[model samples]
Target: MEIEMIIACDDGEVKKLGYGKTVISCLSYREVWPEKIKIGIVHTDGLDATSILSYLIKVLGNNKKSLVMFDSITIAGFNVISLPGIEKLTGFPSIVIYNYKPSIKNLLNALRPHFIDSKIRELAINQIKSYEKIESKKGILYIVNRGVNKEDAIEIINSYQFYSRIPEPLRLSHIITSQISKIINPYAN
Candidate 1:
């Protein structure tokens, strides 16, 4: 199955970018390994759903019988990406919003004595949690074909938690992304 994911780097901070990279790596790993799936990625600076959705339609080139796997849907992000008449065109796009926050206090307690680190962790957790719960308030609607459903989508996303915070697919994608960057920046001696 073809899996397309729209990823947004909400905050332009380095930490947020790093997390975005990890997410890409995990996506790549999942795409390359296993039965070998087709993965598409769209990255945006601001969470503009309309723009994102427009871009997706442009990239997809007529979305008929296509399966989309969304990592999240922030209103802003959703606004940027929601396409007009997209549901009618695209078939069964299963959305997989990774929901599950471990809590800020818990994270700080586990890390210990690192205020900066703690705060960064908190922000990341909050962003992800918000995407899963708050951002999805509008809810996602897709026409399902065979082998597609909300439960299936959730299961696929849940499978990634077994390994690390970043899913295997995105983790691997991040590695590839970094490698490409390194090709230009190279390494410091």
Candidate 2:
């Protein structure tokens, strides 16, 4: 069976870590959607969470079977803290990208919040669970690396739904977005 997954990624570099989304998208391309898949992007002039969510829902349609990924890029903290409403909006299985350097297990150990990442993960899982509001299924959230190489790619994939890692639809989206970004922002690195 083909698995459908949605990933919300970080969209800025540094704090605007949108590249995190690209990394997830790239992995999706190489590992998941090897051929054809529908992909879309949603961004905003400001961090208007409600607007972003609205735009995504409108474009993706209300089919729960469709995976809706968020490019958590640098904006996840904002969502976790303020956009509780968005959690309710995502009626499909959703994944957000977190691009920290350490493994979630390691971060849980060294971080001052003790199990902060774990807590957030649990929170996401639970919130999505509540949002799904259906039996026999629930939305999922994943934390993965911005891998540097093919081996790292494997490690990153081990963290998510697939056996080898990375889903195909998102990977294609990354390549398409990168090329488009260059054309759209020629000077951007």
Candidate 3:
């Protein structure tokens, strides 16, 4: 069997940048270590999809099958990324995982202040509502996926949640980005 590659994208915030630094990780899913980790900066709680995606594509190259996982569709704040666009662009199976049951309307109200652009706000709202539910040890996980069906995505999620309720790629991403953010800016939240 071929080893599956996972490109897990996460962002870290610094007070200096309006957004933060996005860490795009090239990881072997089962092995649980990052093969390539690249950092790309984004506006503090702002638009990062384009820059982060473009950078990862260049680093990862073409015609390679991989899985893309996001800690959330809206990173930072209302800064949203598209799973379908990424799946189409990179030909990778993509999954968006959220541990809590998300309320899009409530999120929209909270995030409305951050986004001046209506389009960005709308996209963020849409992304927030795009997930289907997957029950896990922690709680209900809301997920949206492309290049993989609902049944397969569930199986994939279950298979990955070995050590904990948190998936390996996402758990590793949280660890790495948090550390990187602190190192990048100790004073930052």
Candidate 4:
């Protein structure tokens, strides 16, 4: 069976600069460690869905068959990206994987205070509501997907798990983002 290309995204710790921001890293893979890596910055607790999507589009230019994976929908401190929006824009299946099920109530509580606009908060809540729980060899994973069935998503995820529950592309992206963030913001914890 031929392995489809996988592009996975993950963010590092937020740096406490003006309004707070973090490094977003994405790595592409196909039965290998990584074929390409891209990085971007996004504001913490900001409405950065468009920014995240734009970054992914750039990374996945002309690559229609690749699967896009996210460590979480909410990255860079509540900067939520829409899986459906990504799928529509990039013409690729998208998935958000979580080691544990996300708490909608807690997410709502956190967003309510930060985002005054009801539409923005509602969008985030709706995205969280779409997650479906699935069991893998590693453990349970909560996921939300677009342009792909749950079984295919699970199979793709399982194929990428070698070191941990997190997919290899996402795991590598996380490590790259963390090290880059430390270099960029030495004082950030």
TM-score of 2: 0.40
Clashes of each: 27, 33, 5, 0
- Per-candidate Cα lDDT values, in order, are 0.34, 0.35, 0.65, 0.75
Task: Estimate, for each residue in 40-123, the C-alpha lDDT of model 1 and write its tens digit.
Answer: 233322333334343443344343433443333322111222322333434334343333532435544653463433443333
Task: Write down the TM-score of every candidate.
Answer: 0.35, 0.40, 0.81, 0.88
Task: Sort the predicted structures by TM-score, highest score first.
Answer: 4, 3, 2, 1
Better of 1 and 3 by TM-score: 3
Cα lDDT of model 2 by residue, 1-189, tens digit: 133433333332212235322111222222344433333333322234444554454344344333334443223232331234444565433343322222434423443363434454444333322221111111232432221232333333343434222333343444565554444343322
Off by over 4 Å in 4: 1-3, 186-189
In candidate 3, stretches whose alpha carbon ends up further than 4 angstroms from where it belongs are 1-3, 13-33, 136-139, 186-189
Which wins on lDDT, candidate 2 or candidate 4? 4
> Candidate 1, residue 67: CA error in Å?
4.3
Candidate 4 structure, TM-score to reference: 0.88
Distance (Å) between predicted and true CA of 1, model 3?
12
Model 2: worst 10 consecutive residues (lDDT sum): 129-138
